[model samples]
Target: MALLHKAHITPTKLELLAAWLPARPWYAGDGPLTRVAAARFDDPAGEVGVETLLVRAGEGPVLHVPVTYRGAPLDGAEEHLIGVTEHSVLGKRWVYDGTADPVYVSTLVEVIRTAGNEAVEEFEVDGGRVSREVDLKLTGSGAEVAPATEITGHRDGDPTVISTATVTLNVNRVPLIVVDPADKGVLSACWTGQETPAVLVHLR
Candidate 1:
């Protein structure tokens, strides 16, 4: 389960993304970034906050930007760091690129291999938790493979390539709309505005 708090966050997620997206090598869009959909995955240890955002500027292709928020900076991952911001309830959070986060990678692979779905998110309210609806409906493609223990390498590009010992995962930076004959992949997603499923990641 993903627990969220209704509190003020300095430099909101959108602001943070707006500031960071322009710096990416492959990002080429103008105007403000609007979120098409969003989703989250659970961290078993309940420490890191894992989330994925599908956003774009103007009529550009949808960008899949996944990130992890932690209380402290991750050592040896400075290159993947997105930024730091203050969360009223969670204190300071260090955000990193999710493709470089082991927790995110493992959970992503697990969901695909087991044909599982995203974690259920709940908001903290008056010392209790209540279920919250997410925009994206994610579906994993089941495959028989060894567990993905680590992310050996990842190249951020149009089709981001992530490699592990067991398998190499290819993530599309620009998510394509579902055509009649859709391509197969490790994961797929759909939202209210989207008519059909869009392939997210696949084995390379």
Candidate 2:
């Protein structure tokens, strides 16, 4: 389960993204961004913050961005740093591109390999617990495991593919309205306002 605390964050997520998104080679928008939905993945050790955000700029395509927050810098991952932000509850945080974090990469791969879904989230507010429904639903295929040698992103395709030594993971960076199932191992999601589930990742 993913637990969320009512804590403050400096340079809020949107503010940080505004400055960061425009620099990405895959970003195709130049307008104001609207957050569509978000979901979290639990860190069993309870040290890192893992979350995925779905946002759109005006009428543009919805972008899927997964980020990982850590209290300390990740060694050899300086190139993937998304910038740092202070958390009210957790002091200084070192935010990194989720693809470069082993925890995030493993969890994501595990989710797709085990036919798992998004973790249930609960919000703690005013000493009361409120169940938060995930606006997006995710599912992974139960495939054989293999140690990932390296994971790299490919932007030349329609649905960007994150490739590893043993598998090719396709991510729907720009989501489509239509729903279609893949013939191979995949990671898919369905949103509340969409008529069909979008295949977010495919493993083969």
Candidate 3:
């Protein structure tokens, strides 16, 4: 289930990026044109492969991020992107959504761990904080993806489990990180893309 198929051809990569980049928080410009380049990254599942994308938009700026996806057109993913073009790879066109993809989440964890100046504990919901982590998980493999991670601690709960990823580098001055329970004070997030979002204990 690698990001690209043998017959998927290189041209399809741009088509997919046109639909994916704008939806991201880092994406800037007013629906600027984009140029896509080849990208690949580490895969934890060894099932659904990962993709590192280099996108240049409207002569404004460029973005690099890893995307992991599966299945057919992702439900509710149409409104978030430019367009999901069909590919001859899996016979049917798959959704190009990256925001909710587990692979992307896992990569975010790694990036934060790499870019931060020091280990910092923080919390964020939409997209804030210099360094933070989550206990959320995403479910559904191959296009039917959804968040599988959730808050595992109760109010005033003991912080035995560190539900945060270490911010490695300061992305746009705002350090990025994850809150997955798999993170053990360090940074860790698992992307199985096998189930839906559910409340799970932080494994740290």
Candidate 4:
């Protein structure tokens, strides 16, 4: 499988984002992404991993996303984001865009389900990679989650590392869901009523 060099920052991942982010409905398309930064989360596997990033496109507000990459490309992924380009450290390549891919999503959900659910940990690496993870149990919850395929990756000057994992689970007891007030989505409170609640993750 084509993999990115851990110790170096490369344009391969950036190019992948160049094609994927604008395709999302949430993307605010103003112009090219002027600046891009990354932060790694924790990953037990030393291979591919997870990352959080701020992609600043032109003068528009930057878009924040958590991405998980895996082994090379899977079949038809070449049309998406794959292979090595002129700007990478390993000279080899890594899978760039995998969010839309089911394999990637499933892996993330699995990791979350198995991870420890006590608190949320947020950290930022030297190269600008910011990450967050939590641990929660989703046994009775009706929602389905995916396992983490490749762990998160980060670059701190000469050394690149996958920080840690952030797991999220649901435990029913007055739920609090955050939404954009600009939208007409219903709002709920976590302290709605004192009752034994069951928490569940709603994965749409």
**Candidate 2, 1-204: lDDT as tens digits:** 887877899978887778877777677766898898888887778888888788887777888888899999999888778889998988788887676677777678878777788889998888888999888777676677674546664343445566776777666677645654544466667776864777666676
Model 1, 3: alpha-carbon shift in Å?
0.8
lDDT of 3 by residue, 68-107 (tens): 4454554554543334444465554444434334454444
Q: lDDT of each prediction vs. the true structure? A: 0.84, 0.76, 0.37, 0.40
- In model 1, what is the error at residue 182, expressed in angstroms? 8.9
Question: Against the true structure, candidate 4 has what lDDT?
Answer: 0.40
The best candidate by TM-score is 1
Candidate 2, 69: how far from true, in Å? 1.2
Error of 1 at 203 (Å): 2.3
Kindly indicate the candidate among 1 and 3 with the higher lDDT.
Answer: 1
Best-to-worst TM-score order? 1, 2, 4, 3
lDDT of 2: 0.76
> Model 4, which residues run further than 4 Å from truth?
1-6, 9-12, 23-26, 32-37, 41-45, 66-71, 82-89, 101-103, 111-204
RMSD in Å for model 1: 1.7
Model 1, span 1-204: residue lDDT tens: 888888898878888888888888779688888888888998888999998889988777788888899999988999898889999988999988888888888888888888888789899888889999989888886878877988888888867788998988887777656533434336888887785877787865
Regions of candidate 3 where Cα sits further than 4 Å from its true position:
1-4, 9-11, 19-26, 29-38, 73-85, 107-204
Residue 57 lDDT (model 1): 82
